[model samples]
Target: MTSVVITGKRYLTKPEEAEKFGPFERTYLAEGDSWMDSSAWNQGSLPEFLVRGFNRRGRSRLIVNISTSGHTLTKIVDMMNDELVWWLNQGTYDALLFSAGGNDFIDAARDAPPGQGLLFDMRGKPMPANGYDCVNPAALQRLVDYLNVNFAAIYQAVRSSGKNAATPIYLNAYDTPQARDAPAIRDLAGPWLYTAYTKNGIDPALWDQLTAGIFKDILHTITAWADGRSGVHVVPTSDLLDKAVPGSTGDSKDWVNEIHPNKSGWKKQVEAWLPLLS
Candidate 1:
């Protein structure tokens, strides 16, 4: 099989090592660069699935992974336009695996505590701390509308770049995170919803319902977007990971924080993607 053209952020980032497969085992899909030494990437590591699955398949495939951590969808597409495609030649790869939009939704952390307005408002910012418990259809419509627009542009860019129109672009819905975080890890750089729920004293059941509700909306929107679109497939992943229950938290070790999954957690997600990867 030809090398797969991978790009996006966080969940799709390339680990410096691919374990049994190793970075050296996979040729660099970029031009003029024969190999991507371990030193090339600063932080994010290669996703475990690609490494384990590729090795098991006994295929010598090159992976041009260009994903990063904590990046928004816009930033990912920007990189694809400016840097990634420069490394590509027409028909050089078989597919593109993209993981994004989750960062966009989680970006609410930057807006301070959202008080207690049903968590995410689809606006990606702290909604009015007004303590509302209902979804705002109009505002959500606006947000999802814009989200689709951005996704459309990203798809257009991918299709036009290096004549990659026919390559499949894999996508997925994000998993729900626990409403917990501690000061120890990353300076409590967060379980994302902690500030919002803690600040306003949101009811556990409501919080769970709201969080799950928002993700459900996101999943549906993406599912619709890729519905009839050729070469674009939505890889179901929300089911792969566990969600935080009202009175209890998911296995703490399952996540690094908020949304980033721990090694084992990621491995589970990778298992879900194995069918496509293989």
Candidate 2:
């Protein structure tokens, strides 16, 4: 058993390439955000770790990955219509692995005009009862609705395609990440959560609590939607890795940056999916 990775375009153009690494047991179509496309950072990612895990177990697999970094769920939906649908129409796959929604939440945390964005500007307001007050409830509901609609669209598109109508779809619930100043690469990519917290005047003491509550809402929304949906599996990964320390600016515990997990972290996360995929 062995595993191979190829771009969606390459897979479409040179279908024979995958066979070169086969006598494989299964093939997968994967797409989404940085968690699936962090090769440039040289940090291990979910897709990469899953491949290694399968290989070690003597299960041959081919992953046709079309993921891009920093893409939101909306963008992923557009990409599915643009080209991914072609793959679905032309090929047969055992599963479709998706990793998104994280960036959508991050984007909502960006600084925006008053009454916009997910985090309420706590400045000039009286102290709230708890971290949940730090969020804008209306905005959060809108985001949840938008994500659900898009996910449903993706599911329908796949089901409409005859080739993969019965192929199982797998989505991962991302682990909770500490809101901090850590960036994937200095002066380049991020410090996303920290900036949002600071600009919104959120107390540093509430960062951990706020982030955890927010992710819990998101995970519950998605998991509930996936419930009873045929061929859809949400891999529970929120508890797989140690959360990054609250105020640290760089790698700490299982995290390599503010958002992505290190190699060992990703390996542990992949363990939850192994039994499901097998």
TM-score, prediction 2:
0.94
Candidate 2 RMSD to the correct structure:
1.7
Worst 10 residues of 2 by lDDT: 37-46
lDDT of 2 by residue, 20-41 (tens): 8887888888888888873555
Predictions in order: lDDT: 0.54, 0.84
Evaluated with TM-score, which candidate comes out highest? 2
Q: Looking at candidate 1, what is the lDDT of residue 156? A: 79
Candidate 1 regions exceeding 4 Å error are 1-46, 78-80, 88-91, 108-134, 182-184, 199-201, 244-253
Worst lDDT run of 10 residues, candidate 1, spans 30-39
Residue-level lDDT tens digits of model 1 in 188-248: 3444565556555455445566666667777887787797788888777786666534343
Clashes of each: 5, 0
Residue 216, candidate 1: how far off, in angstroms? 0.7
Error of 2 at 228 (Å): 3.6
